[model samples]
Target: MIPEEEGVYVFNREARSWVKISEDGPWVPKEDGTYLAYFRNHICPGCKAFDRVWEELIEKCVDKLHAVPALVQCRNFFFDCSDRTASDTFLLFLVNATPQVIVMVVEGGELRYVERCYGFEIESVEDLLAFANEARERMRKYAEEGEAESEEESGEELVVEGGNWKEVVEKLRKLLLEGRNVREVCDERGCRFVVE
Candidate 1:
């Protein structure tokens, strides 16, 4: 008996607020800080079993972290109870099972997926809180690393050699897009490339 039109209601403990979100409405962005999302399905037996545990976990960790509870419904199975936003969110995270918990945070103005736990991961409320804490620490570390990299980049200079500057730049661009480390790229190419 879930209302699809209502979308999803989640209590954000960090903001100490309630957020009603939809794919067509206000969605949580990375700039908003850290949040946990719980994906579930109404007809799922695992979800039913995890419901009680989730409630207890919320009660125990309400003051420690923020969480968003979302119910994902299959269009064919629960047509009337299907929520587009919830379903989309589930797909966005590549969730293939019910009772999935994901910790998300904002780093450099972009959403970062921190950690995820399935139904079997939660034996108690403390376990869930611990997972949240781990995710927070990870986000903090990533933010710090990003800041350090930017600071270093600001002070460095790019020295492109030879005549084909465009080709060199293109190769550098491809390396960056491939997620290779900048320092490693520079060391391997023996070129001092500065990212502006």
Candidate 2:
């Protein structure tokens, strides 16, 4: 349900760990060290291109992403999916609204996670996290498995139309599945979700 007012919500890996992320005063880094951070006040978080299948979904959906490890917590030009940076680190998604999505990743920043306001029949924290984690896991499998499949198919007659590796990457960025993740990705997309 789209609310008339904006809000903030935080989802944690821990059970029942969804809390309303607060921004009372200026945001102070949790640790006093080098960190790659993406911050902004107001920005839309949705994709464009209504006609395209998943293009609209990829429009305004990235909040926090790091291109590299920093010596200090550096500001990321305060953007809301306006610029897509080539990062070898992590991705941060910023959703603009009350009860907006706030992310604080401490480890495995490279292993990304995606979040958004309630997508399905969600009523609790676990429900929300379940959706987010499922999407991420499935997406990862789609990419990794698809790559493996492509390797085998590379010797075939029809090689994805002149070997468009980039097109394959684009499919992943769009969250489409090229092959089944029944093997690699360890069926994380199939089962083992926080919520069903």
Candidate 3:
């Protein structure tokens, strides 16, 4: 499936509504970073460039990353800026912002990494793929670290190893090189699972 290409939409918790605020390629995010409520009303138009870029990304990444299946994604940030609340959706697009990809792991609404460079670069498609793979790696590390912290609070040994995720990373490498559907690959490889 293709990702969103245009303006702000609102995701209302109460009514489960997606109200679209704009229809053009360029859309502005509100002060609170919300577009979901607007999109539900269905008024926003699609962006051609964003559509093209993300379509290419999905085609290139779907077979390598199981992430698509697991996350309800939207390109909240389009013009190098987005509000904090806009990131309620799984993905945020820092379009034309930097020459790199930034992966953030938020658990309980808290940032996990301090220093960037989890392979986030804009040099090439290879760079994006590396960023994606490394992003996942870092997220896994964050989760395990969180688990470790929880365990430490309760007094337990850390049993999970980062080595376990290496297999998925290898598959990701194949998908990046061969241009595979990583969303499907993840399910088949059991890296990450989501019904939709």
Candidate 4:
């Protein structure tokens, strides 16, 4: 049986036992980290049942990998369970189901969506470990490919002619890659950029 602190959407840290994610202090997904996120809602019985499996997986396998354990809740409270609206965190991960496990890797400022499995699909700890292993492999391969692509693009010249959308985008990307602020880069290029 899981401890009271270990129940529901609780994050276990070395310094703390269980830091519950509250509506006022929601846990934000890190922009640059390897994370094994468990998405769930408080009202789902399946989610409650899967809590043990998630905790067990963390205890047994987290040390073997770089992915940090994270609990993401769509509905922070039972009252919000009926609300169909998703939080920004859910939208960022494209999470649409409860009791789902997703491995996320943020490498070189790029977020890579790795493998995922529903809680019901994972019948045992071994099964969950296998999924994690597969995700790690995929992340490695993706990193290798990204390096190769960057090497090839490094020698290419950034030339924008007649304001072609693709070329303009590539220029902006290159500027951002060079560690220039988006607004500053756009201003230097006489281009207007807006986010949100």
What is candidate 3's CA lDDT for residue 189? 12
Index of the highest-lDDT prediction: 1
Model 2 regions lying over 4 Å from their true place: 1-92, 98-111, 119-121, 132-136, 145-196
Tens-digit lDDT track of model 3 for 3-38: 243334433333434344432222323232111111
Clashes of 1: 0
C-alpha TM-scores of all predictions: 0.57, 0.24, 0.30, 0.53
CA shift at 62, candidate 4, in angstroms?
A: 3.3
How big is the positional error of residue 139 in model 2, measured in Å on the Cα after superposition?
4.5
- The lowest-lDDT stretch of 10 consecutive residues in candidate 4 is 184-193
lDDT for each residue of candidate 2 in 1-109, tens digit (9 for 90 to 100): 1111222322232332323333332222343222222222222121111112111212222122221111101112112122233111112232222222222323332
What ordering of candidates by lDDT runs from best to worst? 1, 4, 3, 2
Q: What is the C-alpha RMSD of each candidate to the true structure, in Å?
A: 14.5, 16.7, 17.4, 14.1
Model 1 CA deviation exceeding 4 Å by range: 1-6, 12-18, 25-30, 66-81, 139-196
Best by TM-score: 1
What is the TM-score of candidate 3?
Answer: 0.30
Clashing pairs in 1: none
Candidate 4 lDDT at 29 equals: 41
Cα lDDT for residue 130, candidate 2: 42
Looking at model 4, how many pairs of residues clash? Answer: 0
- Candidate 4: tens digits of C-alpha lDDT, residues 1-196: 2333322244455643545444322233436776677776654567777777777776766665455676666443211333222243444344445577887676655554566777878877777767775676786788799888887775656532421333443444454336543221111112122222
Q: Residue 31 of model 3: what lDDT? A: 34
